[model samples]
Target chain A: MNIRTIITGLLLLTALICPALAAKELSGQEILDKSQKLNEADSRAASMEMKLIDKDGEVSKREVRFWSKGEDKRLIKFLSPADVKGVGFLILNADSDDEMMYLYLPAFKKIRRISGSAKSGSFMGSDFSYDEIGSTGYNDDYKAERLDDENGQFKLKLSRKDKSDAEYEQLIMWVSQEAFVPTRVEMYKEKKRSGKAYLELRKVMTAEKITKTGKYWMPFSITMEDVKKGHKTVLTMSNVKVDDDVPDDYFTQRYLQR
Target chain B: MKRDKPILCLCLLLSLGLILSLAAPTLAAASINGEIKLDERAYADGSSNQISWNRAEFKLKVASELSGQAAGYAELKLRTADGPDVSSLADLASKSKVSAYSLELREAYIDIFGFPLSNLDIRAGKQRIAWGTADKLNPTDNLNPYDFTDFLDFGEKIPTNAMKLTGYFDNTTLTLASLPVFTPAAMPSTFDSSINGYINAYLPAGMTLVSSESQLTLPNATLGNSMYALKLARTIWGQDISISYFKGYDSVPNLSNLTLTAVSATQMASALTMTYPEIQVLGYDLAGSFNDIGYWLEVASFTPDQADQTVISPAGTTTTEVGQYTKYTVGWDYTFTYDIYVNQQWMHGFFDERGSTLSDFLITRIEKKVMDDDVLLALNWLAEYNNGVVGNMFGPKVSFYPADATEIELGGFNITGAAGSTLSTWANLDQVYLRFKYSF
Candidate 1:
């Protein structure tokens, strides 16, 4: 063959090998790990507003303040809606095998323990389930596989390593490569995509490079749609602060009464 | 004397309000919020149909950053009802009488946190102290009195003048409270005429029932008559457990002295006296969850001081006796798919005079969201079985939220039971009610 023919063949080979090399560089599991790190911090505090909309476009609003330390403890207090103000919820991930939750209602003036079987139940009557909001990290519970790449975004399919431990059988995530954050996620009841719920993260905010950890991206707005029920919930977060020092007693049951 | 008590109470309440308002500006961060509720109920029997319009309330709260650990709160309610005297504007002046319904201080308390220790809190005021794990029927709950005039509103607890202290540990808490005043349950006056008629019909041959009066003997307002309570609560292995001790007077009065005076061949005057006896109670409660079901058990043993009951017979003979009792309750609740909740409870009363008796009840509540979460439709049914008598009350309500600050509720309650049963006494009192509330 002439030199021109050899050059054409080399060009074709390089074009095919470059994408394979890039694919091998980061597996889906590694991408998920990096995304989690970029999204979560050691401690966080935020004031959030939740808007619930029905199929007919009716809306109701709720306000809450949230605090979380590490990956295990979280506290949420209702701040608005006179009937439900002063209601609190506390969650503690004690060990890998178990989790503890408590609820405080102002009318009852008592703290009550919640059962683990409610993981699949709605969170505060919202479209999001308890497990969805209580999840610490996805890597520990799911086995990930790279699906495809489109428009500078990587798509991954995750299957629960143990089916009994999770509410959803499968989840598909579309992650943005630039910010290392998941832009959209679809949850399936079965292994296939017959019954699915959709979640979208919008209006992401990133911290400036003033902190030692540099810039970190967080979703300021999130929408969860229950396709079967034709219901949707939008959560808008404001006044968010990361790496703030949370009191050690904030996770206790007594704090719920405060 | 009876008519003057309410006026005196109102004057005292108004003076207290003025003082609190004058002192509010001196605090650090003060806020106020409350609701105005208007309720109208139309009874099927038309015996006690009424409309209450002036049910306004405001809660004032103040916190001081100077001490960084002190806060004060007070809630005042102003209420009035339109009586059945006026039907039109022509009778509005002379025929109509406007009276104050209730001017109540629901809560007036000062809370001091981090007192004496890092995790200790003390509250002294006229406040409500709710205890126990059961839903509405708590044998271990004795700190507050109840307003039984409206049986459907069992959740309302009357606040008492008290001093409370709570100490917190890692997973446990200890609470102690002293209630210096005795408050009795407010009973409905609907039973007065019925009880008088029954007593007259059962009288002996030589005696005819004249006017009968029932008097309540309340304990003297003294420090020795004050109530004291202690509770220890802890969480272990995901279960909440508590032990409680209470020394107080029974909120319910028992029939004691019966005297027949002014006796003649065809007429006799009857006087029945009711007394609240002091009692001591030891209680234990436990609550836990299994899967989606929640369960609780509350047990209380009561030892009351021997109370003498004197009965004067038509033959001019007198007899006396004494009485005592114990109570227990077990309850469970579960939520089904579609947000249907079911609660079941069993209560037993061991009376020294009447022996042991058991009562079973089940409450089913179903809620549906319409118009997003803005409108909610709730249906509640309470079925009770006591003393081989079955009774049920079904309430279906629809609440609409025009805005975040306003709620309108339309509801109806139907009560039914067999004759001679407890529920049958108010069988004709089924009502359709509408409530409009606005909060700020």
Candidate 2:
């Protein structure tokens, strides 16, 4: 009586708990939020290279150093190329009404304030737009909806909350379930005429060489390509330090000049 | 004797900088970088169309950590150029053979970060103190004297001997600077022709100003003669807003005295008493980007204490007051699709313009980048409106980045205007230039 009764009770308990412990099938917003968290840090330091490929497939490279602090600040300074050395870009308070941005050109010996709308422009002549350079994820700026899962990835369609506020009207992202990171994104621009609106895919971004640093997941390599221009930017990150010590004022205009 | 004193003081400061740079402990953690550049040019208006400018320049920058909380930086420059007796003004009197090659200490300063307190920084020695948010043409930037020796290389300033103290608060910064040595603006050889008119304007009807031998009267280096500046800045609504005040002599030259002897009842012979005016400047500036446009505004109000030009003649003594003036600049920049960038500015007073009435200037630059940024095309236009006269200087340039650190640029300027305008003097100065630069 003891063996039979114990076995039956254990099987019943397992049946009740297994369903609750199984994968929850995360929603699109939850997946984006999770991927966004993988990129957050109190402070980070990184050395990177950006290779620009022209339509003729000629590649020119740039060496860069990037530092970020808190959730709202980032600084990227060029380290190579005789003409652009010591040039830096600083971004602060992203996605907020009080956001501020600046660019420092060594040749000009001046720091220029950048507008939020400048996000539409390419960064340093690269295919990556200023908005794409930002590590801020799609959670706040866009509304996400989950699509059918495929190839061990969760597909999501994210439409910007305010279409006029951003350069891209929508983005289709393919997020890896295991690493909770976006591996591919298709950026679409909206065209409206005669009371009709349509979305056009204008740019594509793909990430590779994904790795985990402590608790953070990061892509060591990323490529951004513009469809119409036939231009591409390959960004490879190295010497990454998460939660590093960055000064509080590191993202200010004063430090941009430095 | 007075001119020699300032040079001596600068040498002493430079020697101190050398000592600091060579200090064993600081040298242990030092980094050195340098660059060499060459430039050549020709003017279409020259009689023979000869080389208008040929220059080669070398710069070495050294940065060292003095300790955990302090650091030092030094930038030295060596240059060789073809000139009509430039590099030193002593040539005006001694007729010293042209100093085609020269060496200079551009900037040397020691920074004491978090010195005396947790939020304060102290920088002392020969240094550059940039105090405005506008582009290169900041009306509030008066600490360093203009380096107009090569007007073609605009927006350059000669670093002055100074000390600066900065205090950083959360979202705000306060700065105070004291510059002991007064440095006057340097002008190119072409300025010699204009000097006569400048001096004659302040003389009596009988006196006619004289030649290329005009010498400047510089204020001596002393604590009482020091230029002092204060600025307080903060970010409000994501834009930088600052108010500043400068107390010092104007870097722009003006007539202080004239030695004259009566040659006739109505005509007189004249000698130079060249000096700049003492003025106080109150400045305000704002810079930030709204939407897609980056914009800035800088305004400076000048109250000259020594604005009167007094001349004693056979007829009587005439003292004309130049009065006060204001300078302001408003600018904006934007980048469009396909890498087209445009910058435009409107200035009420040019850098050297003074007096109650001043000319207005409109400056614009447009650039396009193609071939993965390997090539850049730019057009620059500067137009001046003096009273009712209008003049424009427009040019186009092409810059090719052949390699990582190499750039070759070819450009030309076309000057056009109605006769009888300040800029019209340079109507014949149409020039074309080529530059080659490599950095490491």
Candidate 3:
């Protein structure tokens, strides 16, 4: 009576707790998991390139190099035009501090700081803003909601965290279930009638040759439509070398302006 | 100076003559250009308030060649800001619905090309004539002296809404433009009661006149009541220089009778002796950018003078001699990279012998971009040294683009100085701003 009765009691207790635990529901945790997967699929550096061929066939090509540390920070440098030979930028996304932006101008032989308010401005007269190229922290700007599951991916409805965070009141992203990579994004920023943009991911390729990290698929090419400007921009990434023992000094203003 | 309203009316009528000539069933090259911008600013003045909106502006330009030697271009702009009201000015002063839109006549002109004139082209209508070789303060680029107050406002441009005629020869250009018969600045007391006192306090009292302290609103103050002027610019030996002159009268609305009587009866009659001058300013600008070094200088003079007498309880009479002022600035910009620039400007305001030395203004800034065009950084130091208005500002700014060219910026302005007296210690005020802009 002692062994049999004890076993039955233990079994009854386990069965009772299982349903309760399942009912507790970890919806937030599920969302984070999906986000991590999406980020992993976009972790490669080589898949992103530096040429913008507009729909009008106007091509602006440059040599762009980028380096990302873990999942939160990255540094990208533009190499072109004799005057901007040494300009570089450093971006950091730490948990405790506001994002930092540093710029190096060769002409002044000094580094000047740009304010966060100027982030949305055109970067070097290009259609893209400096903020456009930096990491888009889900926590800093948007409240993402999982809308539905379709074709092996989760669709999200993103509302701006603050009215001023974006020109668009809402954004929609389609993220893959296996990769967590966003394949498409739609922007609605203006008075509901105009200022809409569509970004479609054309191709995504996983990291190759760099064997230490095998769980990442980076975007190889993307097309952006600026309906208002009557133009389209295409970005292609190539020759990406990650974690190749790059020196910290290379991201300084001196390197950018050189 | 009194406005030759009759002559102005005639000139405006004559301007129509050129429009009639545009009727000859012509095929011209027309272009439509526009920019849609969305801007958001987060103020750091303790309230942590924010202002954000999107503005879509469209400009249409039509240029056509007439006969065998003439061409003309016309431009029209339509703009509207959509979003919630967070603009500091709107919060502090005016309030308008999102539907508030405006039509701006940016450019309208007729040009005579070739002709019997060698190396000469003639243009007429509301035009822009920039003739300075300097950076920020083009003393010689006197065709237009910008109104900082207006230019600093959101979605506004600084040009007299009028008619102009320009003749070009070789590297030299001679331009004569109508001043749109307007006042340089509006009087503060003319604002409606809906405008807060603090908001009205910052309006500059330039050439505009004040009529009464009773009527808290002004209705008939605009460019419709003014006259015209002339502008000239020339380039010599690789250097550019410009000069301009203007004369216009500003009538002090509500100054008709009642307030004058009340003032004449008060013991402050001496203060009432304040003579508001019809302002006339002569501006000169010079600028030259050679290699990586560019320099510019500008000087302006406000004619006539101003003064006042006030009673200080225990100190008897305090003679506050606030006179006319001369504003000048010199600046330089050096391009060290294909996309980076270092621009610095130094300025000084010299008051007439009758004006207060306590009201002078100065500024300096350094700007640059970094991080593969994803990050931009800047360090700025600005100081204004004078009694009741001396302060220094210094801080860093950071700009980030999370996607392509779309931007978001955060900036802090660290300022310290006497809140009231020039002799007092500095009190620091920090401003934090967030901006997002899209241009296509």
Candidate 4:
């Protein structure tokens, strides 16, 4: 089946399942704005470990330390495979639906750009394809459908504008009724059960007066499981300091290599 | 006749009933992949030069994993190249000789997941087997010699026709392959010559080629139609190190000696007919990854059928007093930048002293990506200074992606130096290649 066809069908199904309704029957932009506040308002660095167990019970594990300055900028460093200890990758939004990334290979002592189709590949041999994480900013690529309310929460399903963007058919999210924060996301690929992940708020240490008091509970951790296989990946966010004033230059390839 | 027809009808019904009973439902996943290319080249010998569409490799794969203790998968691949039999250089080098536009079954294999033993895996049918330790130049890729100019699609095209049995236990793998049928085919490098010239000049009489060399002809000759290979490997030192051993059958040409007086006058270039002797190779491989550095070494020895006088050319014959010929290569790959890679390798031949001497070879390459993860550039240089003969090759490649997920690559290669003299330059222009790919 065509990849685009799968995505379109999956998204439309998700939209129908979750009635798109807001307080004012808000426009797409308004709904996105509500969700954007939750992701953009907080940026923290965290160290995480992920494990994937294939259906055959083969387990592959990866450990990473991520440094995030904002919604769309982050640095990830591999900590295992001693030879690759210092190797890292920095991702920065170049534009909507497009991100620039640099990889630092310690053995070559040079930072290189991984161009083209490599982005859609698995990240460090993990089940999570690189495009999934690299393209976290979805505003420019997806057309959001606000589904009906369930327990005072708004549910939205997103459909990709172009097939080349990712391997996913659709993304379904459940937002809190009062906070407008996304609590869970189900990712489907080719109409097959690919992965289902849920986000949990450990605690909201502090909330700035900038906007959205109810959105203070940042998802401190996320756990995902492959629906068809016996595999799961968990990401825990720690070192929860935000707005540290990180400069754009720090995200350059030169700094990443060092 | 009436009784026989009833029996036949009953047999057909029984066979269909068995097939349906054994048929199992399987899960399948598919991907869409292709590549685009833009290239430029200036050949050393400026012969045919054309810049045009470099066709795409479009494939559709439907795979399934059955619920029964068995599973199988198959794929269909097609290319954009035109004509009924125009061989794409890359495709020609690969085992897939079917026209680019021609659609063919890529893979079909059946496997018993948990057979007699939980750890034992038995797979029968057409399969691809990768042996040896070398990454790009695996002597074990011997199932099919890959043309580097082509992308890694050779595996999809030139899968070995054999049955494989593999046992996995505690990070160790033991593999055995048996070839019930083997066909002798010529290497891609020998495609230009006439069959007569190839038979007389390139192929040794007794061995069989796995693929036919000619694009226009069917391979009707069969020799040693059976072959077998065994491979064993185990991970050690916390999975940082591994070693493997492989032994397989290969064909080599040898000629029976005839006195000048014994040959008839009519035997001009055909004065002495060639015979192929069974050639066998035993190989050993070792690889280790320590921290950021990885090293690999592989050695193989070719043992001819017998030690005798043989002629490479009509003018003279060399006696194979040496019983065996050995070739070895060792290399190190280190990753310094997150995305940059470098490698250095050295190879030498330790022939039985009496065999044809192939000069030592050295290779070095450094690759780095640039231009916002949209462009990749690489440079490589090779120097082979044989005893009295020297050859050098230089190549540079650049790949770019206009979109985030597709790539187009262009590459050029140049060769210089005389075959017999170091000072004389015979610069041959290798064609420029443009490749574009899309993947799902």
Candidate 5:
């Protein structure tokens, strides 16, 4: 064959394959958006049991009922553990830049407003922080970039867009290629990783009892471990109902007292 | 007749409780839940030792849909506590041997939601209402009375027969309440006799102090004696703001109609009558947060019909007059870590007249949780320093939860003060207390 003819044929073959490879590759932002959409629901009611394990291997359990409407409104009521029963927490994300949070203690029979700066505090002495549970969407607060593709999974690095808004400066997420679910996440206090991930989420257990309701994929169980603190929190959800009719008044302080 | 009144009421409540329990199944949803607490205290001076089943309370709540778009809610609480002197009728009525226990109705309230208007809610019955931004010591909370017989039981507020109507706007709420029956604060009948003797020593010659008694006079249940209040609350600029106005009889009575009579040559009788007088109060409260600190401020101005005063004569005759005053409190709270929290507050009282004897107080509280929150340790301290006399109280407690449904708290309270200080009167009562609670 002639050299000119072979070169032309090789160029045509490369052009055909490049478009297909590009079609399969997705940006980090696209993966996160897909994952968030799968998790969001119109209304949700769930009974959850949280098991907190410390470094000494001692475990304390708390049972609570949680309800959420849209991305901004959420309510949590402790149902078990006599000392903390009937304690309620409400979070309302306003259309503006601020958020409102209140805590109701049955012992005092009063509802107290919690400060916004408490978002970085631990959530009920668990491994998760209040900001972690309060997070709804990452697209608005974080900028994501694709890091690597390995073992049928996509690795994404997310850094906070507004430095002051979040406690963690950056997060590394490992997402599944097939389901777009996040298999693991690593949190960091700095924007750049020096040698190894600072706070790695070593073990992640997804829900085996998820139910696909409408266009959403619901998970009923999740476990997160704080490697630096040697702490773990296992959250198991049950009796979950989605898209049910929820009264708007349930999000008010009056309902919190009730 | 007075001793039998509580027994008769107890019988009526028992019948009512039976009827309600029988009919609870027919309601849309009904729940019966409560807790039982047992307490014991050992005094440092060994003057008094108290061991009692502090509280046995049961609450019933029922909800049903009424006509149109209205919903009805009814809640009732039955409580029983051990009284002093088991042989006394009051004590027997509270803990009957035959019927196992006599029950007192603590709350019987009916709430109507989604009333005629979509944004209005109404509640009427015997209920406890609290309003303020400050923690624990709320100057704006005057609608309910408190029982101070057990100084350690600080969170309990006596329920009153009242009607409360709240109207909601876009982001604000307006509440109007009418309290029909007046309830006065309950205080211990007996105090330290040494303090009384000390006061008598300061009296003029030949005016010896024999004994003193305080009597409470409650306003009769009448239309003219009713109390009313109005409150407006809103969240503005990331702050919760509220203003309230109350026209009512003071819960704490003033010493009125003081009489001193000579019983013998070297002994005299002194009688002090406590009377509740009509008063008006204007209160304001604000709560917000900056960074990690949550802060609150509450202020109230009380205007009485007459100023309060005390006049002493060489002949042992004493007179008192009641007055206007202002009270304010500012507090802040912060959580240092996952399991550590701290709170501090300063309270000030200012009377319109000079030499009012009111002292400013500072309180601090620290709490820590360990063993994955299964164990909690707390320390609380209060110091009164503005006045000439310095009084202080320190409390340290540790609580453990062996199970989810039970808790035990071990604590000690130490109070100290100058001879004439307010806390010195109770210095003999300093004690270590243990509490056990079970919930269902």
Candidate 6:
């Protein structure tokens, strides 16, 4: 071969190899972990508004202020609706075996530690369960498998690592390619028949709004719906501040009573 | 308490709230909220349906936060209740014109989040200081006295004037509180007759009752009558374990002395004096969950002085010594499949039922929510055993949420037991009630 012909062949070969390197696929767990890292912060403070809509189209609204520090500490206090105002919750080491929760009832002026199945129950009659509220990410609780990439989104199927410790048996997630965060999630309940296990669709959570803040992208508004029951809950966050000063004592019972 | 004292206190608090509102510009942060509720009740027996309560209440709460270190909260209640039912439209119009409404200051307190120490907080004012991990029926929660004006509302406590200090550390907390004076708890209207029977059981034979008249002497407002409490709590293995001590007088009065005189050969005049005796309690509680079942255990050892009554009678003089006693409660709660919730508690004492006559009670509740949690149905049961007598009470309620921050409930309470038993005394109180509450 002549020098010009050989150079042309090399150019073509380099072009083929570069695309292959660029198209290297990522494992499901890697995607989940990267997504988790993208969503994490040293601290977070936000004002959250919740609207619950029943099948009859009746809507109930609530407002709250929330603060979280590190990975294990979080506090929430109600801000509106006189009956529930001053109610607060403190959470520590959530979504783990050592999780602890304390609830303060302003009406009773009592602070009570909560445990057991209460975490799996509905949160303040909303569609979100306490478990869902406390879950920071799915990487630790689920075994993820890459399903496919469609419509510029990475699809994943996550199955519970341990059924006894998880509320949902399986979840289907659609992550945004640009944001590395979940845009939609479908929760499935597990059922067993003749020693065989299966899953059924139970609830769907969709991110309605996404905003970029300080090189990170987050869901600013989300909606969780129970399809079978036709019940929907929309949660919207505003005034979100992250990676700022949050006192460790803010997660204690003293701050909860405030 | 003087009938007008509550009103005067309400006026003073209102002025404070008004000033707080007018000065909101430089007060850092302030908020005001309130609620209104109406309740009505009727008896269940046929042909004699009598109204028990026609109460309307409005509660107002004001709160302020200064910078990031201090906060204050105050609540007031305005109520019109227990007046004669309107027999005609004219009665309804004229009854409101009279001074039948009463005002009360429920709670007022200021919190110093971190001063003098970064981990200590001081709360001072007239407020409810509740200390316990159990659900309601807590033996260690004694800072405030009970409020039984509405018999169906169990575990309700009246706010007492007090000051509290709390010290916090890693996984531990210590609380100290003091009340300047003693306040007695309110009881059901029929409780006097019931107490008469209980005291008579301790009297000698042939001491028949002339008139059911009893007098209660209030504990003097003195430095010695001040109430105090302390609790030291720590978290161990995700469980809240606490040891507490309380020095005060029992909120419920007991028969301290009785007198008997022979009017005729067979007729006897009997008089009884009720007084609150001094008491000291040492309490321990463990609250945690095993698996998916939440459980709590609390135990208290009580030492009461003058528990036995001194009897001076024409027949003879009898003095009985009251001994030390212990009270305990064990409770467990779980939410089963389909969102059915069940809570059960077994307690060794009820109210002032102490000494050798202490009763053991089993209280249970089963509840479920339906229609997207807009409706709730619950059944409450209580079983009591004292000596060999057994008593029971059942309460069932259905609550519906028709709007946000509003609730309507229909409920009933029923009791059954042998005559002269504690439960039987409340048998005549069986009734059905309807409540409407709205919060704004």
Residue A185 alpha-carbon offset, candidate 5, angstroms: 2.6
**Candidates 1 onward: DockQ, in order:** 0.34, 0.48, 0.01, 0.02, 0.42, 0.73
Query: Per-residue lDDT of B1-440 in model 2, one digit per residue for the tens?
Result: 43354465468559757876667564667766678888888887758687878889888777777565887888787777576454456665532235445668888888887889978888898887776777778889999898877857775788888889988888898999999889998876777667666556655654553332445777888889999999999988767999999999888787655555566555556665667888899999998877668889999999887766666545567677778789999999888765588889998887777787788989999998876677999999999998899999999999998877788999999998877665787887888999988887
State the C-alpha lDDT per candidate: 0.71, 0.80, 0.48, 0.52, 0.72, 0.83
In model 2, the clashing pairs are none
Candidate 2 local accuracy as lDDT? 0.80
Docking class of 5: acceptable
**A198, model 6: CA deviation in Å?**
3.5
Q: Interface RMSD of candidate 4? A: 17.1
Candidate of highest DockQ: 6
Worst 10 residues of 3 chain B by lDDT: B253-262
**Residue runs of model 2 more than 4 Å from their true location after superposition:** A1-25, A55-57, A105-110, A191-200, B1-29, B66-68, B83-99, B199-215, B257-268, B311-318
lDDT of 5 by residue, B56-162 (tens): 55555444443434444444555554544365566566534323434445666777775768888888887777888888888788888866666676535777889
Backbone atom clashes (below 3 Å) for every candidate: 0, 0, 76, 42, 6, 0
Clashing pairs in 6: none
For model 5, the DockQ equals: 0.42
Q: Residue B81: error of model 5 in Å?
A: 6.1
The CAPRI-style docking tier of model 4 reads incorrect
State every prediction's TM-score relative to the real structure: 0.83, 0.87, 0.46, 0.51, 0.84, 0.92
Q: Write candidate 1's Cα lDDT for A70-177 as tens digits.
A: 888888898777766778988887324546778888556667666565555666567876666635478777888888786768888888787346656677887777
DockQ, structure candidate 4: 0.02
| Worst lDDT 10-window in candidate 4 chain A | A201-210
